[model samples]
Target: MAMHMAMEVDQADDPRLQAYTSIREKDLTSGHGARFIIEGKVTLETALRRGRFKLESLFLAASRLEPLADLLAEVPADVPVYVAPQDVMDTVVGFPMHRGVLACGIKGEIPFPANFLDADAKTGGPSTLLMLSGLSNHDNVGACFRNAAAFGADAVLMDGQCCDPLYRKAIRVSSGASLWLPYAHGGTGADMVHAAQAAGYEVWAMTPRAKAQTLGTLRVPEKLAILLGAEGPGLPDDLIAAATPVRIPMSSGFDSVNVATAGAITLAHVFGARESP
Candidate 1:
């Protein structure tokens, strides 16, 4: 591991740190230009390990240097890690995130969802994909990524209406799984279903509707695409009609779980079914 000396910063508005300025606002309203923020030591380290992103720079509290030095060695020599005192770091970002670490990562060109599905098809073996629709809540989005990773899903596909999984809180809530999971936003729920179908994946639309088959009956095909919708509205009826509709068996009158929890349960069942002799 190579150690690079860190640059010290005394001012909050240092032009070099411009990308991190008022970042909470950017976290809420906009995507940083061709870049996404990765915060926390673990998530930053995971991004480095995943090797899927180009790390632009790092901004860290001075105290983090010794702790993160070994991991920093793996970062390319060209990337600067800016070190600042705690208060200066707070002033620069206009908020205090106790995590004390942040990295700017360049977003690579997002390939179509079918591109990933195609890659899975080339294997001629079992493949699993998690699909999301209209999930605007960052926490739910993050939890979904976490569940997808836990169940061994190959990649995650989301409709445009879903929140960006790279949003800082989402990354944090995912505990860095978002950094490791392969994911992309496709067009819409129907578009995702078509993309999956075109790629030879059996599309299973998750719903609470009684007409849908209980998930207990599924054996999980060699290539499976499971679709989940936003909490309140669930999957659109037309989209559900298009795909094989499946529902988790719940209490008689009660309808649903949190979307993420629903994903976890379904994915767990699929994982177990796939493992069974």
Candidate 2:
């Protein structure tokens, strides 16, 4: 009874209420210098279990203590666990009734561009890299990283225009897959393509435009960089012209597929092709 009472007291005074309430792209960017916020219980749990475990702290509604006892047990005792009312949790997050938990995890460091390219320059073999230019949606960016891992791609390179894969919504949508993926900031869309090619990656720009060659028909290289753009705009003509254009055949009238979906399919084919090479 005493322990329960203490828990309630702790809950009433929890300072994380302020932290949770302040969570947002800007708040995350300022508070801990965090580039991302891994919001909600399931996402936090998934991240913790994934071994990368970038969590800074955990927050839970006091009422949910009993239900999350097992999950909370595995967390290090030193880690701060704060409890609050469900209303407080929801109110802070600008939502209602999540799983009674959320965690703030630090974003991982991105790798250098050289790590993914220039095999002959002494670093390593031709590393597979993903380039996203003008890919604005966070969900798409997250999904792309998920597929990159599944396809065994070495790392991801997002140009200035792409969405941040570490954003809260993106991280949740990815089921925490984005946490471990190696990625680097690709400076500019045009410069990114040029740098990738200079590093010896055969850039294959994916587009569904009329004159595009089918991805199935193209010759896959030992070291390839697959480039994808936003859904509606597709790859800008300059970017497409800059890269070796490739396409995935679709039934007539379907026109095109989602950028992330198309990227996944292309990644799979590229992965298979690499195996034979």
Candidate 3:
């Protein structure tokens, strides 16, 4: 192909690079202006391949330009791709980092939580959802999204209590699954459950309580919503009381499965177990 088209940025304060400045601090807020940061080569590539979010721009370390030529060439000519020496990138990021790729994405219009619950209806087939609540850790949120996508869940519904899945760290941890996964954050756990149920999903709130139905014993449903809570506090008592409770049977006295892991096992049962002879 023809030579890669890119601009060389020598100063950290260049006007075009404003969106990438002090990204960590910007992450502290709601990715202000409905924007999010995509870091590392994998996530950047995922965003490009999925076309789920509009990329505002790309800032890469000088070394990455050649290695990512093919990927960069695919970038729309309208989007600015800026390359800078490692030192300038470090200054702009305000941190010690090893990976050399960064991207800014516009989240565009946020979707209604209830509307997203029905996005899969047009397919005329089974649909699955992964719901989360009170999960403050970005890593857990990301892992859950990764698992949900891996298991072919149609979407994710995270209550207001959960952290932003688009956070840069979460995006990297999820390998950019969140970029393509249909998710609606910022609703109460109750709101999520009601919406899923209204969409004809069998809502199962996952918990460690022994009285709940064990995952191995339950018959998975065609349209299902698996609800998981934060690490320390599983599902709230009232929430668990509201839905059919499901549990992953564990060895004696060992009920502490990471929320994300529990999600994977239950999802596997839904997507993988039935096919087994």
- The local distance difference test score of each candidate is 0.86, 0.72, 0.85
Instruction: Encode model 1's per-residue lDDT on 1-277: one tens digit a residue.
Output: 3434788999998999988998988753244457889988789878888747788999999888888878888877789989899999999898885778999988766656766666546557788899999999999999999999999998899988998888888988888888878887857778888989998889999999888999988768999989999999999888898899999999978999999999999999989988888
Model 1 clash tally? 0
TM-score of each: 0.94, 0.83, 0.94
Global local distance difference test of model 3: 0.85
The sequence of per-residue lDDT tens digits that candidate 2 reaches over residues 1-277 is 1223313323433465555664552445323355456666677667667636456767777777777676777676555676677776766666775667677666645443444444333254646778889887878988888888889888788886776777777777766777766676546778878878887778989988878888888887767889999979888889999999888998988878898899899999878877773
lDDT of 3 by residue, 1-277 (tens): 1245688999999998887888888763364368888999889889998859888899999998888888887787778888999999999998854798999988876555676765545446677889998999999999999999998888888888999888998988888999998888877888878887888889899998989998878777878889999998888988898799988889997886888999999988888854555
Give the 10-residue window scoring lowest on summed lDDT in candidate 3: 115-124
Q: Who is ahead in lDDT, 2 or 3?
A: 3
TM-score of 3: 0.94
Off-target runs (Cα >4 Å) in candidate 2 are 1-15, 22-27, 30-32, 51-53, 108-126, 275-277
Count of clashing pairs, candidate 3: 0
Ranking by lDDT: 1, 3, 2
Screening candidate 1 with a backbone cut-off below 3 angstroms (N, C-alpha, C), the clashing residue pairs are none
